[model samples]
Target: MTTEVKPSPRERLLEAAATLTYRDGVGIGVEALCKAAGVSKRSMYQLFESKDELLAASLKERSAAFVASLLPPADDGRSARERILHVFEQVQSQAGAPEFRGCRYLAVQIELKDQTHPASRVAHQIKANLTAFFRSEAEQGGASDPDLLARQLILVFDGASARAGIQADDLTGLIAPTVAALLDAADMR
Candidate 1:
């Protein structure tokens, strides 16, 4: 015999927020979030003090998952430049997916830009984490200035994502060569 355990209210709610907030927008009401999660408002309140808290939690969870997916494993047997440029290919593939709706971190920031929101803080931390990833890769690639190289590579990664959201087409062919040049220039290749 086997037993199936349901996901906790917090986990369920975060899953709902991940789908709804990204698909519809963060303007989605608390009621909608609860309904989608198949959870009671009480459950939501029990885990998170408020809807904003849930929003921040959702963003944090989603961004961490996403950045992990974007970069390949360190032992994937590829050079740093190959691994780095692979990110552009990911951006295009994700954007071209039927449900693509821009970067969730950027989406939340746009929704909460004016206010001093915790979601905004989480988004900034996600970007910092990404920059740190790039810095480590640049070091492996043997860049003379790994920090600056990481910053530039991060900008390329960001711009390609923004373009992907708007263009919603495979921009990898256009972006990858430039990144290759960047890697070569920095001795990352």
Candidate 2:
């Protein structure tokens, strides 16, 4: 008979950390995360060696999931600009979902002042990856300076997130016009 082993302590800790950080932000303590994940502190330490390591892994996982969610599937057949706008649409869709707590990486960065920390490093990597993705898409859409366009789009993305978090309103209306202008400028250049 083939045996199926359940997920390990490390797997449990990673999953729990991702969930808690996404829902409650990164300020929650390690003990709370361990308890929520139903794993012992000893097991967590054994797997991660330190809370910083565990937090980094969790943030990495969350970052991957966030990017994946923003990307359209291969069959979507959308233009690059459309695909980019669709990302904003997805974010807006999540606004109405229960318990939406805003972007996980942003939350972690805001909570941690020491940028040298492991979690902060992971967050910085995530932001870089996201910015690169935007640049690539902009280039594919024929933007003259994909790098500059990507930076501008990132500003719009961050501004929209901030508006949503602070005003509890969808900011896509403001974002869409900015993206439209960007696309128009790209066509001109």
Candidate 3:
């Protein structure tokens, strides 16, 4: 016989918040979140200081998996150019999914419209990390201007993700070429 461990209330709330807010936007109410998580309002309050705190904690909890999904494995033996492209490829793959609502971090920041909010701060940090990855890779690839290339790469990423998420573009025949152009302009091999 085997026992299956159930997620604790905190875990369930985090999962619920991450899922619900991504699907419904940051305006999702506490009642809906607690209902989805099967946790009571009182329990939620006990676990988190407020809804904003819960939202930030949920985003923080999922940050590792989010980065893992987008970033290439460490020392994957690929060139910096290839590693950089890998991130876009992952985004393209994810955007193809029906449930894809664009980048959750992007959505949260936009919806909250408050940089000082805990969740917004968390979202900002996550995006900064992505930009840092691009900067590091651009430098390693010997780009003419790593800073410019990194900024351009992240802009492309954000745009592609937003366009695809909104179904405005499938991102097919789009991301790779645009990225290649940017890479070439920067003289990255």
Kindly indicate the candidate among 1 and 2 with the higher lDDT.
Answer: 1
Q: Which rank order by TM-score, best down to worst?
A: 3, 1, 2
Supply the global lDDT for candidate 3.
Answer: 0.96
lDDT string for model 2 (1-189, tens) is 999998777778888888877667677788998898789888788788788889899888766678888767744777888877887787777665666666677777887777899999998888788788778788888888888888987777776776676556676466677778987887722
What is the alpha-carbon RMSD of candidate 1 to the true structure? Answer: 2.1
What TM-score does candidate 2 reach? 0.86
Candidate 2 vs candidate 3: the lDDT winner is 3
Report the C-alpha displacement of residue 27, candidate 3, in angstroms.
0.6
Better of 2 and 3 by TM-score: 3
Whole-model lDDT values for every prediction: 0.82, 0.78, 0.96
True-structure RMSD, every candidate: 2.1, 2.9, 0.8
Candidate 1, residue 64: Cα displacement in angstroms equals 3.9
- Give the per-residue lDDT of model 1 (tens digit) for 1-189: 999999888899999988998888878999999998999998889999988899889888887578877888767999887788777678767877867766777777877874478878888789888889889989988898899999998888777776676664457477878787887788776
Which runs in model 3 stand beyond 4 Å of their true positions? none
